[model samples]
Target: MPRSHVALACLVAIFWGLNFLAIHASLEQFPPLFLVALRFTLMALPALLFVPRPQVPLRWLVGYGLGFGTLQFLGLYSGMAAGFPTGLASLVLQASAPFTVLLGAVLLRERLTARRALGIGVAVAGLVLVGISRGGAGAWWPFWLVVLGAFGWAIGNISSRLAAPPRPLELTMWMAIVPPIPMLALSLLLEGPRRITDSLADSLTAQAVPAWIGLAYTIVFGTIVGSGIWVWLMTKHPAGVVAPFSMLVPVVGITAAWLVLGESPHLLEIIGGALVVGGVLWSGRLVAARGAADPAGPVDVGDPGASAHAVEPAAR
Candidate 1:
């Protein structure tokens, strides 16, 4: 990789790493689904104007949008709000990588490399360790739920790859259009009219500055800037090269949570997190090297939506 591309890729990692803090902050103020809806609403408005719709068939485009946009985030936000720790959420969500490989093997009839198979094994083992260490707690289910969110993202990744929209950024923007309504509907259905009304009333009554600011950051930084840069990078580079850096998010997420939110992981969680990330990184590097050597090989690197299968609809 060129030095400039390397630098840009690292910057993209930072943007995504910091996004956990953004999500944690936003969740503090707004209910998960409602806040997520508000987020997409903010994301879609201006983007709808500047980002042209892709020339792809409407079915594929819409499928890409709904899968990646609506289902993925819905599962993610719900998991986080339900008490999935930010750091673990970041780590476990990486389940999407293996999920994507599996999906590709099944759906696209893609062959799996040995390294990918080994990587998946190591990652699953690490996840088991992490789960065992963290359980017997208040919110363990959300952690698993977020893992589901990662799966959802993997599914979305496959959809995007199969769909092959004309313009990735435009496709990303169009995907943004699908999430808000479904999220809002879910919010209303589950959170209910009274609770939603009450939460809004409380926010308005208190004039919660943090809530508003957090919302802005999620929309501007997490959604537009973070995801937009990610989509741009995916267009430029191989997905495998780009995707491994997502492991760095937990490093950032945990540290930020410790400093900002005063949340710290146990020693076991820390060690497990290290194993999970390092193993994935090693596997991803192997995958990249293989791709570079084989020009005719099917490319499945750096998909941002790689975790779609793990992400459940409610969890996002």
Candidate 2:
């Protein structure tokens, strides 16, 4: 990879990392579902008009949308709104990688290698420690909700793989069409119409500036710019070369949360986060090794969607 492309990749990681803080900020002004609805609305408009629909069937698109857009963000935003810390949320969400592997073995009948099994075990242990740490801090419910979000993300990864669209980025943009109305309906049902109206109105207030800024960052930088650069890098380099940079996302997320949001994680949370990241990296290494060992096997390191599968944000 060119040094320029490497720099671009790092920039994408930074955008994605700071994305958690954006979610944390936006949740302060808009109800979780409502904010998510608006996010998809912005994502789908204009781009949906310009980008051709992916060549996949409607069922696949719908399934991907529901899993990635609706379920994933619903749990994530709600968990954040429920007081999940930005840094910890970033670390915990990495559970999606192992979750995706497990789901693939069960649903797609993919083989589970010993290395992957060991990685999964380590990740699960780290997750348990994280849960215990957070629970001790009185954030049990929100932590679980984020874990649910990670599972939704895993399901979405499978859905995307099943869809196998020729253009992954276009499919992602089109899937944006699926979330707004349903999420809005959910917001109305759960948050109540009155609360939704109040929040929408309040978004125009001075206090809501940060929220709106956060929304803009998510829509523009996080989704459009970050995904665009990721797709570009994938085209320019092997997926293995680009995918590891995604591990930096949690690093940036945790650091940004600490610096910008004044979030200081507990010592246990820090240790657990290290274990989780290490485990995920270990899993990824095994995948790369498998791909190398059998070039004609199922693993396709050049697949455009591989990076998305590994690190694509739910809100993204």
**Against the true structure, whose lDDT is highest?**
2
Q: lDDT at 293 for candidate 1?
A: 65
- Cα error, residue 159 of model 1, in Å, equals 2.3
lDDT of 2 by residue, 109-149 (tens): 55566765776678778878989999998989999998898
What does candidate 1 score on TM?
0.83
Question: What lDDT would each prediction earn against the true structure?
Answer: 0.68, 0.75
Tell me model 1's lDDT, rounded to 2 decimals: 0.68
lDDT of 1 by residue, 1-316 (tens): 3445556666766766677777877677788889878887877887788777776556656665676667667778889888778866777777766776677667645545677667667867777778887675656777777777777777666666554554666767777787888889999999988877777777764556677777777666665666566655544544445555666767777777788878888777887887777777777776556556655332553333333223322222
**lDDT assessment of candidate 2:** 0.75
Best by TM-score: 1
Model 1 regions lying over 4 Å from their true place: 1-6, 204-207, 235-241, 288-316
TM-scores for all candidates: the values are: 0.83, 0.82
